[model samples]
Target: MVSISRRTFVTATVAALAAPARGARAQEGSPRAGGRLSFVIQPEPTTLVCFNTTEGPAIQASTKVVEGLLTYDFELNPKPQLATAWSVSEDGLQYRFELRRNVKWHDGQPFRAADVVYSIGLLKSAHPRGRTTFANLLEAGAVDEHTVVLKLSKPAPYLLYALAAGESPIVPRHIYDGKGDPLQNPNNRAPIGTGPFVFKEWVLGNYVGYVRNPNYWDSPKPYLDALLVRVIPDGAARAVAFETGELDLGGSTPVSPLDLERFRSLPHLGQETRGYEYSPTLYGLEFNLDHPILKSPQVRKAIAHAVDPAVVLNVAWYGLGERTVSIVSPTLKRFYNAKVPTYSYDPKAAAKLLDEAGFPLRGRWRFALTHDFQPFGENFKRSGEALKSALAAVGIDVTVRGQDFPSYLKRVYTDRDYDFTFHPFTNMFDPTVGLQRFFTSDNYRKGVAFTNASHYSNPEVDQLFAQIAVESDATRRRALIDRFQEVVADELPVLPLMLSKPVTVYNRRVVGHTIDSAGVQGNFAEVWLRG
Candidate 1:
């Protein structure tokens, strides 16, 4: 195993800090303080609350209204947001944070350390990504009005990164504490947060609006008086809105590949492939091990061999994606494992494997299974159809079910009702942030949302994740993560198809639209429109 020296890690961190800063553009003159910015959001979230759902739309919408203890810069480096500064124990078991004083929630309630404690507790229990990311958090308590401390059972080196990823948005204890099942709280429709924007209104399937937070911690920020997020589901319509100056910004993947070149020719438009820096997402087909046919590793391997990711990239993604075998994307410099087992496009091999696994096509099709296409983007349906057609050639019949964001989450994450699903597993900043939960057996709760949907449990893989979590040494941690990927590749729990690049389009009149590596979830506090 190759060791990642401390120097290398420091260099990476330094390099990240050295990246281009995000804020008002220098050429755009002084930062003006007032204008409404209209933008396009493709997926219409079921709820305005981000913590209740893992839908990308919900999270992106909530980002403007809610603020976390920390957030990432353009280069994916952790920086202060709600919390001004922080310190960690030498052993990495305890964390101390200094909360920003004089901050008030959108409802005028003073922000306090108790809110931090309550928010952390809520994340540990209710939030999907937070459940695994903050699993080691033994206790979190407020030391004083402006101070909070977190006690972990074991070392969690990536905890800060997880907190900064926008998954665990801090909510007010007064509003959410006594609410029956915080997930179902009505306040989710109109959240009260301490961020730069105040939730003004939400019209389902139409639009969600936000006005400037007058009492925001940072004065004179959120230059725009209001932000109007239009739900334009059709890619062409969104592109047209952007082109016609009807929308100041087009949210992630708002402009389809077919329309990208045309938009590039327009001088008033700007394109970005940044903002997904922290989340190196892997798009793939996740198998449900609970199913009898899919329980066989050979069948899973055959399915992997049947589908050609290159073809999917061309037809569905328009060659905008990179083929991947490992669950982690190659962009994650430190933890990516390039040597994992890869499956080539070979239908003959897939058929032979199916025959050996007892599902031989003597006269009729070997078996039929249902697949759910996760509503990540419009192209998911095309990708699902491609996979279904590919598997048909191997005598495996598949029925593809396309669902909206809410229904898809309910069926796959809550009900666990399907045999296979096409979706992207994201937030892969570190092994602990995104990848660990999928492999750990303990995370496979029956009705829990965004746990182990695949129901895959390997003792060795679980042990490796546990070891990787507490291992403080950078070198040893990378080694353990490499081993974990090898186990995942061997088991074929999730056949990784491609790594997706999130695209964001905007009108050049909108200045200070900082495109961070965090992708579409970029901060809009400083964005101002030019007349």
Candidate 2:
């Protein structure tokens, strides 16, 4: 990883001094259970269950109280959770799971094969990413009381990584059975599950509290007596809390970038970047293809050339991230294509392209458009200002605007009120599950928060994703991904900005938090304090 100082960005490899080895406790002493753990989640989660939403906070909160069929190690190999053992047929069409016995829900009901069957069915139809994640699923049937079989129409190579608790949580069949619109069900707000923690109370706009489940399937685990998630929206306040040692743990870079080095230097604090491999982030400029002016590829490509990613890295982001050329994250070395077309920073060429595209300078400006930045953090707002400044130099007048999270969602996805916006998306464990949703035609569902916000569609891109999804051969799949990147880069539906390296900050007193690939998003079934 690269280290950045306030004065300059230096290319250096530095091991996280505060972090412990992966899959191990922080200190050498045995863990002691009984203290309460307090953490922070920004912008308050809309629901406690993340089956229908992919908000990072909701996923982190839900996974503690909900479980999935399988877990994964640091190498991403499947590990035991609800499903103890599993096997796939030679044809790659059938998967059989051996359920862990003696596991009971928090409400005292025995977990059975029906829950897996029901949950997958809902996921394929309801979950935003699951629609594509489980598209090949032909049937989810129960072989017996403790066995379940999933038959697929074609191979899904990335299916294993998609079963982690955060992405695809298993819900109780009884409580949601025959319920009208699972999205609107009350269970989402107050979830009932078979995880290590139990939902206790949610004092709206303040905090959500949970008590350790005494009957948790994994006994003698979840050593903490209780878990408290405080809703601290401001980045400065979060940094202050960390300085005071009032917060125990927080993930996804909870504090501002300016405060990162301060926390890293503190003796009582530690920061880790290991656990987010399963969910790498991509920040980009999304263009509304339906708009009259942006529909031209020349204009989109010109805008891409006008902005400088170096300034984006050093000035706007404070060198917190790395620039990316393709929609797929560079962290995924196997499929990332470094040879794809790149748009370098060139203002003269941008003006020439606009002039050739028939939009000559009208007085002092070519055209004017409104811009919206993602309201999740302060960096994106600075990025908006940077974009406005950059475009103004190319004779394009830009009006930067800001809104709350809810209003931003409604205006962009549902109302289509803006021309272009700064957006961030999780490319997840694979390109098929994460990258496919942004360009495919079928995923352009109106009112959906994260799927195909740009309304960009191409039949060839869709075909490439379909082929990549079912292609079992590694060599052939890589070829298809390369072609997909070439087309998407040429079309320029969404300008690839930079790939983010998110950090998880925690007190040295915390242990067993970053033991898995999911990191803090894991169920925390075995997490405990060092005391």
Best by the TM-score measure? 2
Tens digits of lDDT, candidate 2, 396-437: 999999999899999998999989998886788899888787
TM-score of each: 0.85, 0.89
Q: Rate the local accuracy (lDDT) of all candidates.
A: 0.80, 0.85
**TM-score between candidate 1 and the true structure:** 0.85
Query: What are the clashing pairs of model 2?
Result: none
Q: Among these predicted structures, which one has the highest lDDT?
A: 2
Cα shift from native, residue 150, model 2 (Å):
0.7
What's the distance in Å from true for residue 499, model 1?
Answer: 1.1
Alpha-carbon runs more than 4 Å astray in model 2 = 1-23, 26-28, 178-186, 360-363
What lDDT would candidate 2 get against the real structure? Answer: 0.85
